[model samples]
Target: MKAFIVAVVAAIGLAVAAMYALTSNQRFAYQAFATTGARVSEPGTNLVGEKWTGDPNTNDKSESAHGKATGEPSHPKRS
Candidate 1:
């Protein structure tokens, strides 16, 4: 009984650690695009005019263009 309990606890701990790593490792594509200035277009979504911090010159034109075309709302808009 004691060994079974320990095994269960270890399994639970491993599961929790795996969950944390998965969530932390998963990167938001939109956020990445925004940061790198990479033009990312979805079929249904219109994410144009998004302003990013990185190099303006090196940043993709489509991305920057979208940023300019739109109001360039601040990402993760501050309250």
Candidate 2:
């Protein structure tokens, strides 16, 4: 009986987690999970062209501090 109760509790916890992930910002959640710690990139395997460095809409140079070479903003600013 105790095992059954524990199983039910675990199932409920999973359901709640799923619901939260569905309702919350999935991209930021994924980013938080991915980059919350010191991430090591394998040499020659870095995809700088596919990241914010390649994003033309971002002007923030912070990506370099994180190890990326940035370019100009692809989108024009609004007045």
Where is model 1 more than 4 Å wrong at Cα? Answer: 33-71, 74-79
Best by TM-score: 1
Global Cα lDDT for candidate 2: 0.47
Residue pairs of candidate 2 with colliding backbone atoms: 56-73, 56-74
lDDT of 2 at 73: 23
Worst 10 residues of 1 by lDDT: 42-51
Counting clashing residue pairs in each candidate, in order, gives: 2, 2
lDDT of 1 by residue, 37-77 (tens): 55454211444322334344434455434324244433442
Top of the candidates by lDDT? 1
For model 2, the stretches where C-alpha displacement exceeds 4 angstroms are 26-79
Per-residue accuracy of model 2 over 14-42 as CA lDDT, tens digit each? 99999999966444222344443433332
